[model samples]
Target: MSLTWAPALERPDLLAEPVRHALEAMASDGADVAAVEVTEIDPDHADTAVLVEATGWDLRDMANCIVISGARAGEERVCAALVLGHTRADVNKAVRKRLDVRKCSFMPMDEAVGRSGMEYGGITPVGVPSGWPVLVDARVVQREHIVIGSGLRRSKLRLPGALAARLPGAEVVEDLALEPPT
Candidate 1:
């Protein structure tokens, strides 16, 4: 019997109401997109290290999503950056250049939460507003599956790395990530 395994994942519906573009685009396109698996978590355990330790999932298979803004007078330019667990976005060089701004900085937590409609730790790339650049490190796009935010701190999402590369405004940039310091 040919069985469908990917759909067995729980909570795909949780993303239903507002319909995040990232996930929606993948599902709608129906080509080269992997099924997504979502898991609920305690709000306090939403951070990387905590979630890793609690679930014992391989650290390398996880990616983080960060929201950043460019400094352009009278214009709102925001980008959602996706990098691996042990890596960080190269905000000063790569990101600034990509966003074509003089400076780029992490969006303030409160502002991020408000604009994303996602909790502080749960902001994923799925539902980012249209035209906002979703910068994804090339390294992340090769993974078979990676855990990312689910627009709510109470859950985390797992899907194909290729799927993330296809999200709206997703730009697969080389060297978008920098190794954490020693």
Candidate 2:
């Protein structure tokens, strides 16, 4: 599949409201949001497995964003973890340690969707709520370009890994994710 990537700002219809707003904000801040590209596809192929098979893209170049919630001393903490599709977030050890919480787990799907204002299976860290930490696995930042959700099921976004690391509140966390054991 030869995907034609257009500047995301030129295709607001392909982006969810929050995603469009977030990209616009980034552009205003001189963040070079133009480097972001958007491409539309069948909603059924929005998932990582189907998308990779359909596009022939390497799984390592696809970024998966997961929301996690936990509490430390009764103070709630929620963050988004960005990992490559080939790995899983280390929610039990790495994430809990990062959040300084006794325990942390994936946030409920409905709550994550509602809080992010993005559709489930299509949430990206680009537009997470203010104050929410976005822990990006260090490996994701090493990719030349990473494919991520467009905050909607009908489209996807591609941008330089360095640009992703620059998203507001995003932090590159070493070993934030781990490849599954064979």
Candidate 3:
């Protein structure tokens, strides 16, 4: 399927408020705004698997941002972990270790969507709450271009993998994802 790409800044309607603000902030920080683009998509195809089948895009070029939460000593910690569409976040190990919490689990869908201000199935690391750590799997950062959510199910964002690593509060974490069994 051919997709029409437009500069995300010029198509603010395609982005959630926080996502637009985050991209603008990155531009002000001297990041190349031209590197970010948005494309319209069927909301029904927002999930990674459906999107891959609908768009014929390589799954490896897609990134999935998963929200995870944990608590320790009465302190709650939340993080967004970016992994390749084909892999799973190691929430029980790598993520837990990084959050310094005894255990971590995927945040409930309602809470994740409500807290991030992004639609469920359309959450991206770009606009998660400023305090939440945006942990990126090392493999994701190596891709030249990665497709991620635009914070709206009707659209998607494409940007350099390096740019994803530069989002506010983003931290590159090695082995943050586990390969699925064959």
The most accurate candidate by TM-score is 3
How well is each residue in 1-182 modelled by candidate 1, as lDDT tens digits?
11123331234644523334555555667744446766667778889888888878777788998999986776878899999998989999999998888988999999988887777788888777777789999989989989887787767777888878877778899999998788
The 0-to-1 C-alpha lDDT of every candidate, in the order given, reads 0.78, 0.93, 0.94
Better of 1 and 2 by lDDT: 2
Better of 1 and 2 by TM-score: 2
lDDT (Cα, tens digit) per residue for candidate 3, span 9-95: 999999999999998998998989789999999999999999999889999999999999999999999999999999999998999
Model 2, runs deviating above 4 Å: none
- The candidate, 2 or 3, that scores higher on TM-score is 3
Ten contiguous residues minimizing lDDT sum, candidate 3: 25-34
Q: How far is 175's C-alpha from truth in model 1 (Å)?
A: 0.4
Ten residues in sequence with the least summed lDDT for candidate 1 = 1-10
Instruction: Give candidate 3's whole-model lDDT.
Output: 0.94
Cα lDDT tens digits for candidate 2, 44-93: 99999999999899999999999999998899999999999999999999
